[model samples]
Target: MTIVNQLKISAVSIKGAKALEQNLLEKISKEKYKPHDLFLSLEKISNIYNVNKTTAQRALHSLVGKNYLYQIHGKGTFVAPPAVTFQVLVIADYETGTNNDFGSIFGIPAFLRGVLKKIDLEKYNYSPVMLTKKKFIEILPDIELIYRSCRGVIFFRNIDIFVKTLPVLKDKNIPSFFYGSDALLESVSNADCLVYNEGGITDLAINHLLKLSHKKISYLYIDESPTQKKRFNLFLQENKKYKFCTENDILYFKTIKELIHNNIIPDIKRLLKNGITAIICGQEEAGVYFLNKCLMAGIKIPGELSVLTISNYPICALTPVPLSAVHIPIEEDAGRCLELLIDIIEHGSKSEKHISKTTIVRRLST
Candidate 1:
């Protein structure tokens, strides 16, 4: 054979080996194939790849570390499906929860579920993964593992963790998105977000109270989130108009129990001290808690203090006050959030952040 022809033949042999390796990897990605099936008789893949049984064994061993396949003592080798997309991993966050309170933890998940229900799953088969408030830094390795399995992620109510891992996703060309209130507003340009319109919603709740002639308002809030802070701040800004209705002004509290523990019974003390007669809660859960506290303190509702909230908790009606509240459009917001996430994943648009508005729903106790 000519020297040049020999060189060409050698190159083809090397190329073929590499091609076989890639082909196996792709098969793993495409289906849940088992290594035992590939090595069913050892003679099978050998003929298929035109490689000796020893070379095939070496290739299979190399893929073991890559998580493409697994070995079973009695059964055989099994192939794992390619890691699912971002949505598949994040679905947990979209499931319904017991209550709608930040402190409840399930509130965010329930809201996400409401959103995911409206999304076209065929196009965006992603899931919402939950990360604890302080576990971001320690979770990088696991996050990286998921990255190898899936190409995208939908982070839920987790900013610090998302920020820490987002750069890695960008480096690996993995798409990352956020839903609900974003803790990393500046990094928002790098990630898509479906944020809640706390300002508009708080405005709606405050306006609802105003229509009820509730001038003496106090807001019982938990400052665990930036979103809640903005809601409280906006409520204060709108409280300026209450001066026109009566001298009873608005006040803020960190926690319902804290106010009581500090001997500062906001509803009762307000009535006796400042003549404050109405309350607007940051969330419906807190509204219920406050209403119960008021009743225990012998405070009359609507006759002494009207209670309203910014969130919708069905249990609010069971409260002694039968609290009134503005319903946050959680279901609609979820749909819009998933739609925006899909837009980011498919079209690569990272400039605009979608914010859904909150609407007021008047009920008793107003």
Candidate 2:
């Protein structure tokens, strides 16, 4: 095995074989020593580096162990084909409360649990990262290195980072998939995305309630997020479809305080007195808070006023009444993402992309 003109390298000979090792790594990663190309023989490296054959052999074996090069029984060493790494750059958005382990975070987020569960641990390494949007410009260089190093990326609910990093990823030829809601991501189109059909949640919930003989269904929620607004608009559309538009059927709360700590008894009694037989909550946490308030008021869920919710996470499932809800198929979406990513890594970005569907999980609350 031979590589010409790399006859001499000097980087603190005290670092010894380590410097020689770095030189070889630079050559391979830069594609100077390409796949199946013979690397410098141990004898040549030993002479060039002015190191013992044992030291050169150790350096060669280190690259072999890392799969950068391979040694045939009697044929010396040759560069191995660049292996597609299992490392995936998982990007997460952080608010006031969260954590990060260096570039990667430690604890898994609720949405990420399903993703991690469906990921092949033996073949894939999921790296969760949280970089603040405010610091985006400052961290651009570090972010670029991350994109270049990873074979693929899995981003959850971080549209800003996903959009900003797309160009760098394209420059590095890295494939990425961002899982989020349709409402929040409607404007972006260049990257692969798994969108929670926010409107579908409204359709599913409304259809379910209407089928159960619920004519006077009202919409209620705090935190008018994009997904919530989308859900509400869809609900209005559905109501229009059935010619059931009534201003009294919609209740909007300004904050979580209004749903939780603020007086809600009058609101509950008002709905019942007005023959509002059911309520569709825009957010699961809001629904849970409302449910607890109802229970405190001795109101029977489903029996008195059926409760339906749009579940972005597992908040509804943890309830005592098991609220009937329109759910994002979190695990299914994640599984599909994993499959799509594997296909992209193996067959290129032209590999067919598939998006998972929103679903309805019926329970006692409805």
Per-residue CA lDDT of model 2 for 276-349, tens digit only, reads 88988876567777877887889999789998877734556677777777767766776677667767877786
> Best candidate per lDDT, number?
2
In order of listing, the candidates' clash counts read: 19, 0
| Candidate 2 lDDT score relative to the true structure | 0.70
User: What do the candidate models score in CA lDDT, each in turn?
Assistant: 0.61, 0.70
Off by over 4 Å in 2: 1-69, 72-85, 94-108, 121-138, 144-148, 226-245, 351-353
Residue 356: error of model 1 in Å?
Answer: 1.3
lDDT of 1 by residue, 1-366 (tens): 999998886666556556766877776665555433543334666788778666566667666666666677776666644445453234233233453434345356565566558655575666555544344345455766644445456666566666777787678666666765543465556456777666666667767777777665666665543465566565566657664223244344565555445544643574536656676777545677677777787877778778777677556556665777777666667666666656666788664777667666666687
> Which 10 consecutive positions of candidate 1 have the poorest summed lDDT?
87-96
- All candidates: TM-score: 0.63, 0.69
Worst window of 10 by summed lDDT in candidate 2: 99-108
- Mind sharing the TM-score for model 1? 0.63
Model 2: residue 50 alpha-carbon error in angstroms: 29
